[model samples]
Target: MIARSQRERLLEAAVRVVAEKGYGAATVADLTREAGISRTTFYAMFDDKEACFLAAYDNVAEALMRRVAKAYEGEERWPDRARAGLAALLGALAEEPAIARLALVDVGAAGPAAQRRYRAALQRLTPLFEEGRDFAPGGRSLPANTSRMAIGAVAGLIADELAEGRAEYLPGLLSDLLFATLVPYIGPAAATREVGGNE
Candidate 1:
């Protein structure tokens, strides 16, 4: 338990250090000092700065996933639940600007670990798209793979907007953009019904 706590503390410190200094400038000493742990403890916990960074990335992803899971709870319709989840996530990102930057931008520069983390998160998120099974109004069903791609695209757009400091308008824009883009693929009848339901 103590070991886990120390690892978490180190990951938190690593996030702060990376957010403040960028991945290129962040150092193990900086994270150790920020975590209030000795260098020996830091080294014992992580193989190196890169290893620490990967852990930090996982921590951020886990935090974001928790927010998503909470946002999705008790929502019946897939589309409605998706939009709410997106809004909650964007709101969380807006509130935690540093963490947002770290997750969306700094991690990208950290190497393969960043890409792996992104893929893992996307994989975890794919199941949410299955909720589209509720769209029986149009007699057209969305393929799970396509839904996953759509979700990934929407997430990518949100990350781009957040990185550019345009997150304030992202919720509405994402809703409209995703609706427009995905409705076509889902077919006219399904699209019409879904859009009508939103109004």
Candidate 2:
């Protein structure tokens, strides 16, 4: 097998170490050791532990976005695409709980840069949420910031599950999350049917 790049190894190691030790406690030495690379190699790719952690966070977030986007592809309806994307995301988190925690939890404490990156990721998702606007009641329209708030609320809930060591239970929240996201636009009666229709 071909050997992995030093940068990839370092990023993977950073995700594992940061998830286990938290960004504050994890060190460059720990990252290099976990990656099985020399300190020189780590420095060659990243300026410091924070930089490596930020890179890892970006990688994780990008990977998740790709999965969600792919799942949303070829779907005619917004609710169908939303369900598909949620399933893809929850499935990914289930398979990579450590990286999930690293991206969702540890990144916040890593530094202001990481926090900004997290906020950017959330902002980027607003359009995905906004796509459902046409499904809302004819006269009832959501506010401009409603998408961000819904995304933030769901992110907060996912963070709580990860914090409680119940990451595996995240998929179970899909219906409720989907309901919460679409309810404002679709209204209760339609939203209830949309959420429960899948069952």
Candidate 3:
């Protein structure tokens, strides 16, 4: 097989295998079999199963970030941008339950390395939510961890939905997730109004 194709298939298989079996149970053999690649090729691409899973996790996280960032681009206001970004995120997760599971749920079981990677992946979205600080009324005075807290809230909400086997219903959570994201940056009254304003 072509090198690039095998690599892509391996990464895709990592997502599928890990999502189906969970990180602890998924083995290198399973990844290779799922990818239709040999052990040698798999080793050539990655050091081991964890390495492969990490690569796959990063791949999905980066793509999801790109989608949310793209959605936020044209909206004029922070609330609108937040709505657009959260909608994009929820819609994407809903479209791929395996990805939803793998990204938010499976990685936690993968081990310390994977957990660190997951945390780092969540951190990458900081800039997206950080923009809300400048948009808020007491922008500069909000808690130092405003962006991180909002990110955690958003991630936690999505993780709960995914853990409950409600991936397909994720898109419908747009309002709730938006409120969680905006409430800290804005406030309850304005956040509630913004949540209802667009619907």
Q: Write the per-residue lDDT of candidate 1 for residues 52-88, one digit (tens) a residue.
A: 8988888888888888778877487666776666667
Candidate 3 CA-lDDT value: 0.89
* Tens digit per residue, CA lDDT, model 2, 1-199: 2234777877878888988888888888899899999888778777888888888888878888888888877576898888888778788987888878777776778778999999887676776778877756562356777788778877887888887888889899898778777766677788799998978
- Model 3 lDDT per residue over 58-88, tens place: 9888998899999988698888988898899
The numbered model that scores best in lDDT is: 3
lDDT for 140 in candidate 1 is 47
In TM-score terms, candidate 3 sits at: 0.95
Model 3 misplacement above 4 A: none
Q: In order, how many clashes per candidate?
A: 0, 1, 0
What does the lDDT come to for candidate 2?
0.80
Clashing pairs in 1: none
